[model samples]
Target: MTRYLEGQTAIVTGGMRGIGLGIARRLHSAGAQIVIWDLAVDGWDSVANGFEPVMRQAVNVASLASVEAGFKEVVAQQGRVDILVNNAGINGPVTPCWEYPPAAWDQVIAIDLTGVFYCCRTVIPHMRERGYGRIVNVASMAGKDGVQYISGYSAAKAGVIAFTKAAAKELAQDGVLLNCIAPAMVETGLMAEMTPEHIAASKAKIPMGRFLQIEEIANMVTWIAGPECSFTTGFVFDLSGGRATY
Candidate 1:
């Protein structure tokens, strides 16, 4: 692997399994120190992947104080964070809008939208001070459209896109490049948890007729986190395998 990211540090939220972990491994192989932050909902830890000298982090994206404490600890130990990947999100509840449980809906929004907000709030300021930063947000293709049965997720991801755009503009002059990746029907464990019927429906919509591999998303993020994205901010990179028209 190239050392394009050598001497850099990355904080990957939800970085224990699936998409986030894939990103961590890829970046590490490319010579970036890894900070793995996951709530243990899926037993996600960097040690399992044989990451030497991993920065183990315990974070609760729903709470601002938890994010503050977690990132503060990471910086105290690692010194600085050069890249921040906000990949923690939820598919949210499945039900008609009127019939969805208020708690479930709020829960999804809390993690997907508010979580990204908190991470950006805590990490970007440091980036601004350094006069450099690369922040990649993992939004979904559903964020660009209204998919049936996951309204909360769609809305939250949509918020991520808009938020990325605004933040990018604000930090562009500060050398902070903020962007969001919108992927469709990725074959992460998240998809594995969906009902077979829902999975089939999602597959049928993909023009490529298959879900994306975890590495595919990681590859996209890797480039965005590197020098290649210096000129691109507030941009949306599509990884839908042709599922979305726009």
Candidate 2:
């Protein structure tokens, strides 16, 4: 079978583990040269998956300087970036909006919202210069529905969704398609940060009555990052397991 993404280069933020790693694996399997960008590179060498990133760089996506340096390195090594999956995020503290810590809220916004902006700001020029690119921002259903007690995470994700749409429109004719996915609860390391009550409440809201599998998310991302995802820009793909009313 011909690999659909042959010779392409993909950068997956937070790719050392969780949903990001799953996306990296799927893209690598589809023939994209993968680069894992995260704050650490530990545990990746021990992952059982046969797939390995062509390169791994420690990057703090929330810092524009760090993002710029990381992308500079990627371009120097790979010559070009064909796809970017902005999947790095934190769930932040689960608390009522009024009672949420300022520091915690800022942290979530910095990583989950500002980080995506930084990555896109740095990568778009490269993609525009090359006349091709695909960007998938991993948002959440919480962004749309506004989960109670997780105001920081929900607000940041909502920003991501809005940013994706605006950026897609800006790059519409530039051959860079930008989109976002709003997935319901997915069982990932991030879940450990959530309260048991929050987790239970989230699952109960899902019509599917279960958390999403990593592979299911990876499958959607694989297609979105490929050339076949043409004609769909500035759109939000829902992976809410029937819980999304909109």
Candidate 3:
């Protein structure tokens, strides 16, 4: 409503749906032009059509080549990217560490953690040259508290949290603030990947006794992606609804 981000452009990875779509809509509402990078899985066109003039880029965040090419296309069209929300990720199979398939673990790490690295590695330089930027990564509270039966997901997200801190320090003086949000379970399609028991267990851990709304995560991310969040970098903001105090 404030239009604080007016005249800026933002790229939201995996922005076709779920948490990524929520953040893209929020940034658009704040007056930033939206560029959605997604693999454009089935039924994606209908979702893309619902948005107001969103620039859609078919992208697979897990691949560095795809990420690089996507970044180039965005710059070519938008001129510059003022905000980047690295929200693309997948929750690997819900299984114990011992039972977790090695390939599943690698896949999760590639997309959830390594994808962030690829995006940051590609964009930081461009942002640094511009002398200003805001990047918010969507992490998870599971990374900190370590939820059972989701070892791959937990480890990948933990890596994301740590990655944010380390990158933020390097850009502290460069006017490029990097931060991440560690949210508890949210009411997103991502839950479809988990079993009912796992979902219930996650919700029960929240003191609020409820899952997070997509708009709530969007609200926090919008603020962090704005100029007002100038003082903090390399920090993890909590959106766990009292499940994680740290």
Candidate 4:
């Protein structure tokens, strides 16, 4: 039939690097036009050219106006967004509950959890109106398994999963599907921010004995965002390399 994403448009937050960038590349390969909203700006990355009219906007996900204005800009430039990938997120310091910084905790919640909320709240209406749209949210295995050192990040991602389920139920009747993916530890520069010991500990838990590749997660996102993703809403797809059971 029609090449799945032919003539379709997409918005990928944090699409400049890592898993988000990978998803942008995947969707582009499938024939979708893309607009990237992210804070990272490096001129050398080849993937930046993958998206047509790739607009580079540095945004703090916590700000409502930024979300609103950004989506508005996407629509203004691209006409309508057929797919929305909520992938911009963060992991605060790996500290015990008592040691967690209040400000840092807020930052994590804002970027990881509330960022998804802001995007969903604004973009879902367009999908609901179009009666044909797909939204893929990128959560983490920690959202399901709750790692020991990142209580705040875990709690925020847990909210993301719950929100995905609830929103899926509400939007399914409108022909809009929403799904969440939980990846364990994907190999990306993000890991560089973590301590060596922490990364080693995370790798030790995965039965696969190594970190996940960014492209692996991107494949899942593309599958879920495509036209055939019908009949599956509010479901969480696991990509933790067998680290999760639920």
Per lDDT, the best of the predicted structures is: 2
Candidate 2 is scored at a TM of 0.98
Q: Model-by-model lDDT, in order?
A: 0.87, 0.93, 0.90, 0.86
RMSD of each: 1.7, 1.1, 1.6, 1.9
Instruction: Give the clashing pairs for model 1.
Output: none
Give a tens-digit lDDT track for model 4, residues 1-246. 246798898888888778888898889888888778887555735534554435666665677888899888878887788999999988889888999999999999999999999989989888888888899999988898888888998999999999999999999799899999999998887776688888999999999998999889988999999988888999999997888876
Q: After superposition, how far is residue 112 of candidate 1 from its true place, in Å?
A: 0.3
Segments in model 3 whose C-alpha atoms lie over 4 Å from true places: 41-50
TM-score for all predictions?
0.95, 0.98, 0.96, 0.94
Candidate 1, residue 63: lDDT? 93
lDDT of 2 by residue, 87-198 (tens): 9999999888999999999999999999999999999999999999999999999899999999999999999999999999999999999999999999998888989999
lDDT of 1 at 222: 95
Candidate 3 residue 237 Cα shift, in angstroms, is 0.6
Better of 2 and 3 by TM-score: 2
Clashes (N, CA, C under 3 Å) per candidate: 0, 0, 0, 0
Ranking the candidates on lDDT from highest down gives 2, 3, 1, 4
lDDT tens per residue, model 1, 1-246: 788999899999898777988898989988899988888744544467756435767799889999999999988888889999999877866667888789988999899999999999999889999888899999998899877888888889999999999989999899899999999888777864477877888788888888888899989999999987779999999998888788
Badly placed stretches (over 4 Å) of model 2 are none
Regarding lDDT, does 2 or 3 come out ahead?
A: 2
- Evaluated at residue 76, the lDDT of candidate 1 is 88
**What is the model-wide C-alpha lDDT for candidate 2?**
0.93
